[model samples]
Target: MTGDTVEAVSCTQLAYAFGETRAVDGLDLSVREGEVFGLLGPNGAGKTTAIRCITTLLPVPSGMVRVFGHDTARDRMAVRRLLGYVPQQLSADSGLTGRENVALFARVFDVARRERAARVAQALAAVGLTDAADRLAGTYSGGMVRRLELAQALVSAPRLLILDEPTIGLDPIARTGVWEHINAVRAATGMTVLVTTHYMDEADQYCDRVALMARGRIHSLGTPAELRQGLGERRRAAGTGATDTLPTLEDVFRDVAGSGLDDQSGDFRDVRSTRRTAKRVG
Candidate 1:
């Protein structure tokens, strides 16, 4: 990003550890204002840990994290007020009606009491859920449930939206629906988006730029096209002769984190949790 480009999120030499295991290792990243930035990585590459720090859910023990010029550690509430997050785990209440769920978030975010109903309605409409807003979330389809969560995050009218694997277990149509809603809202509001996903095609099609991480650090950062072209150029220069077809985002992913069999790739617990989320949403 250019020096003059506004940054919505910035991290400098950020590091975090779990016991003796380092989750994030001296990472530096910046998400420019009003752009969709994707953080792509295998499990245990520290993507979630880094996100937790940026969201102020975890302390920045070793370095700095800033959201829209406010330090996360120094101005936790300020940072929280500017951000709307949808975590990988399910956050929607199946027992409550969709409208109720969003209204609850509006209260949690301290939306003005007078504007709460209007904001809740706008959020539901933005996600194509207004017609079903009064239905209990337990009766919702998987796609509807995910859209409800998105509505919940949007009720606060946040400046920055952070999504952790927002489309994790959805089918192709559902995934596209989620992205369409996200893009539509972003275009209308100019809100900056930060997302982490393992789906390379989604990253290529939706993200303006992406950072590939491995071993708790960034290995590559560029637009999807740029990263793919870079890999093609390197392959041609090395006389691999496999350049008959242009490389893909998945190819770049493999190039950055080959096999993903390293000890730091993830643990049994990580596997279980990811599977659980996928199953629940499935």
Candidate 2:
């Protein structure tokens, strides 16, 4: 895609701070249309902060952020209409049934009442939850809750979807199921997706391109293959002791981010470590 058609999302020198902590610092990124872009980072690395800015949940303090060429700050409503966001935390109302929750969002988005039913049904079916549509969200498993969130995000037929660690707190099977639905939605609608995840395998398998971030900065940005190739080249040049095998994205992450993968709390932290490592070795 040309830059014009491809520039679904763009951030230039984006920065955010909370008191003394610099949550996001001088970050730059671009996501193209009809592609899955993964923001891979560790916990406290500013992935969510960046998402919040792009979604217009948090105000832009220093940099420019545009969604579909509209300034996030000045054109907040226009941007909101074009984008759907599924936050890291479960958004489903435990007291409401799955269908009820989605219908609520549809109403909030001002979807026509006559069309709400079909829209909710379509979203539920898309996520393979039509059978449990009437079940309370609290009774659903972590994975089911996630799927419901995805359904809610899709109810408005947004052109751009921002998912913050969508698969967190799920078993491997459920994680795979979430990915399946995400890919299906992308394939069917050609919607641009920007996902934040600490799952290396998820990024490797699903994202067309990934940006590795650390300490509120982008360390590297490239396609999964390109990242692996770049790491391989560096390893080859580093000579025999670098590593015997081709380095995965995890290795590239470590080399670029200068950190090791340690078991950490929070799904964001887990995915971040999957992307960050101590060093790149041969």
Candidate 3:
């Protein structure tokens, strides 16, 4: 997966603006072939907007984005052929069975009928959904729905996979299950993954590298260890004399992107606060 293959994704000074607001601002990023690259950010931090531009779902308002060595703007079809996207929103039709949803994606991806059935079956098995393949997605658990979405993405066996908030709205156990499947897919196929996640633990554990974005711009980019090291240096430079230990990714997140977590916001904020408090008490 790493020999002479081209970069899975490349972006230089990418920017997107909506009215008076800059949704994504001057972001530069690169994902190596077969690597799991996490885009970590809180809500409204332009992670989704950057993904949209890279996957060709949304036009790039400025700068350049390339997929598999093809310019996103000049070679739309070539880019689409090399990539698969699972949006943050639920896209499966509630009325359709899990298998049916995968089949639908196969068709949309222009997979031949002779190959679609086998491809769909393989994708379902990869995501551990073969047992529930015939069940309606509406009846599946939140975790199952997310896995089904992943199966859809794998139907085409794309070289690059883009996922936005892939594990949102799931219990910890369920989220772990999703991460396991994601890693399994990467191991089996050597597919490049670009994921947006607010879960600091997930990024720290699974990503080979991460780009931290805030308020539509990237504030930092490096491996989790590198980012933590940088944060340690900053803390020392600030003369806090808090040489207890280097901060975790969550601490770095709060330090770089101001904490906006509040009870009313959503489960994410609640989870973040709970984890922070537990860390302090521990």
Model 3 score (lDDT): 0.85
Best by TM-score: 1
lDDT of 2 by residue, 219-247 (tens): 88999999988888877887743567778
Model 1, residue 127: what's the lDDT?
A: 92
| Ranking 1 against 3 by lDDT, winner | 1
Q: Supply every candidate's count of residue pairs whose N, Cα or C atoms clash at under 3 angstroms.
A: 0, 11, 0
Report, for every candidate in turn, its global Cα lDDT versus the true structure: 0.90, 0.86, 0.85
Q: Which parts of model 2 are misplaced by more than 4 Å?
A: 1-3, 240-242, 260-282
The TM-score values for the models, in the order shown, are 0.93, 0.90, 0.89
Ranking by TM-score: 1, 2, 3
Residue pairs with backbone atoms closer than 3 Å in model 3 (clashes)? none
